[model samples]
Target: MNKYIVKMLSVNDNNAFFQLINTNRERLEDFFAGTVLRTKTIADTINYCEEIEQKINKKSYFPYLILEKESNVIVGFIDVKNIDWNIPKAELGAFIDSKHEGKGIITTTMASLIDDIVNEHHFKKLLCRISSRNTRSIRVALNSGFELEGTIRCDYKTTKGEIVDLNYYGKIF
Candidate 1:
């Protein structure tokens, strides 16, 4: 019944964007332990913001910053990636502040992002890949109307020199 999501439309709040990514990087590092996903330094984070800015400029990606209402802090974010106009499919990615894990913040944020993107964008399908070991992410995808497609065996290099399989999920717009 309350608004739990807001897109990063105005560029006036540069601090907000940096703050969100800086505070959650550690949690992201852990969540994506098997992959090189986190921004280890401020420069990297800045570069990321710049990259996101470029993506937005090109209309190739749309990102949203998720703010937890009571706390007024960005506890998580959901992004639509790999947007392909021809295929009408976009890859999905999400992250939540570790402190807020197990809560439904990501779900709420996801619902909001999906609704807006579906209404504004013409993409016909959404695609998501979840590390096989990350059950929480898989659950979120399944609960959010995503259907499990198949498992890709030994598809990626994870941390500690381990290979991980990824489960694919898809949904129609």
Candidate 2:
């Protein structure tokens, strides 16, 4: 049996989804400011989930909830955003529950999703923009078959109001 199941984010996932973001707000605030800041309440999560569904239907963003099969809880999330249909590429983003970190769950799940992103989604390339200081995520990108493309200086300001460089990693399918 699969250890994890990846389901598209839906409105019904509001509660568990909010809990996941709330539980890791501190850890995610630095790099994942958009989600951490936007989803501060269950109501906020409901709105965000609705927005995600709209984006999915518009073919602009695809977000998946990673469910741990045994516990049936949301253990992580993966997203394909910034899609450029012309280039047929998208940027990938992901975060795992703090409790489930370093268990190879994100790595394995990402590897599998890479296949789907290419074969099923018909994406020509996938990209991951990771903070220069986040070695864990850089390793995840490398281990999942992405190569360092370049670095963007002062990519964006974090929720803490600190600017950080982002390392661009990409895999061409």
C-alpha lDDT of all candidate models, in order: 0.73, 0.91
Over 16-117, each residue of candidate 2 has an lDDT whose tens digit, in order, gives 999999999999888778888779999999999998889888989899889998889999999999999998999999999999999988898998888877
Q: List TM-scores for all candidates, in order.
A: 0.83, 0.96
Error of 1 at 113 (Å): 1.2
Give the count of colliding residue pairs in each prediction.
Answer: 1, 0
Which 10-residue window of candidate 1 scores lowest in summed lDDT?
30-39
Scored by TM-score, the top model is: 2
Best by lDDT: 2
